[model samples]
Target: MIERDPLAPSRWSAEYRTGEFDEPFPWKPVLGVLGIVLVIVFAHLELQSKRIDELHTAINARLGGELEPLRGRFTARLSTLRAWLELREIDGPKMRAADLDFETIRSGGLLSVRRKRSAPGGGSSIELDSDEFGECLGVPSTSIARIQRRLAEFTPELRDEIDRTDHFLTLRGMQDQLDRRIDALLPELSLAIEARFLLLSEEDAEARELMLLLVDLESGQEKLRMRVPYEGRLLTARVMLDETTRAKSPGSIALPTELPKGASDCAAASTLREAIDGRHSIGEPMPEGGEHAAE
Candidate 1:
């Protein structure tokens, strides 16, 4: 027999050696995936915490830095209104007392921040209501926005207040109380006046004459009272404008029909007596010149 070569390939051994079992890697790829997932989870948590802290800081800055000055302004406006009312009370007596108490008229939601997460592609924005802004500045909702325009000069400050917004909701209980007071006053004033007039005037021959005289006197008083509010409003506007910009220009509004051109010695006697009882009235055009003269 020929000597067998150890290195010679044999058909049976080659067929058997074609496939072999692979050795397992010492470090599992599954463990590497698990570690990667853990790192992602930790990073997400840290980012969320940092965002929360940023939001908290923003709120504090708005509350302490911005809202405090706004509160002071509101209080000052209320005080000014009160002073105006007091001046009128001192000057005119027929008009009922005006004690619009600010303590009772509670204000809420000065500087509240609302955050809404964005939609898929949209960015977040804030909205502010005019009524809410008015309340923040201690102005009536019916205010003609003069204050708004004036305050707009302080743009950065106003924008900050507008952005860090909060809902200003009045208490239902307080609103109900206010509603009741308004309701009681609305229908009663005219009725009370008619009743009082009837009680004062006799139902006989002198009744008509006495009623006419009383009407005349009341009309004069009404004119006087109207002047008080007009003058007070003008003065208030002037003061507010001065406070805002140190402006010294006299804001000349159109003179009404109550102020006459000439002077009269008697208290109720009108210089334009003919006009007062006739078509043309006091402070109205005296035939030719326009209502407002050139500067």
Candidate 2:
């Protein structure tokens, strides 16, 4: 047999060589691995960018839409409160009696009571005929209570608005100031995960404290608004008395009698000014009127 040539060309020679493999395209494995990693990283960054945009959009919706409307409602209720306080001269007993007289004639109570003036003042004139004055006094008080109830609805709405704003701004500031960069450029997935956890932990604590304070504010404002009508009706009634007498008799006691000691002492006075000073810890006497009344 002819001696086999060791390096001789054969059909199976290229396939059989095994010592040190080399390819015509030697860099393909390294390039393929790098391309796969690049694709994955770019896709992850795209998704994160989309999520950050979504967060910003969510923030705008809550701050502008919900918060603004609730604030407007609070403003409107405040205006109503001022109007209620200013309406100090609401009609008293005589005016209400006149209104009732017109209604009674229309409804035919006139047919029942004969108008008996005691033959040219033989005794002290019956001041109000008693029963009619009681009915008349309820008018201004009822009107004031109606205004109070409208204000009552604001307490909860305002609280909710404040809590919502607190939550949104806290989250928004965190995302804007801290998270945007780290989430985008970091190579390792674990680092981004750790950062997100830390940020959320801090935000949660702040939100809880803010919510509690908002609740307390809501309760306090509600109490103040409620007392206004209770005290306001009394003051309005007194002012009405002064106006009625002024209309008929000309000179009389001023609408506010000189406050004895000006409610300056802590002693009990039934009037609105005294009540406000006691409640608000204001020792200085409010001048002659309702809460906003000029001194």
Clashes of each: 1, 0
lDDT of each: 0.29, 0.29
Tens digit of per-residue lDDT, candidate 1, span 242-292:
667787766665444442211111112221122223322323322322111
Query: What is the TM-score of each predicted model, taking all chains together?
Result: 0.27, 0.26
Tell how far residue 145 is off in model 2, in angstroms.
24
**RMSD to truth, every model:** 23.3, 26.9
* TM-score of model 1 vs. true structure: 0.27
The true-versus-predicted C-alpha distance at residue 69 of model 2, in Å, is 1.8
Task: Report how far off residue 142 is in candidate 1 (Å).
Answer: 7.4
Measured by lDDT, the strongest candidate is 1
Return the TM-score for candidate 2, rounded to 2 decimals. 0.26
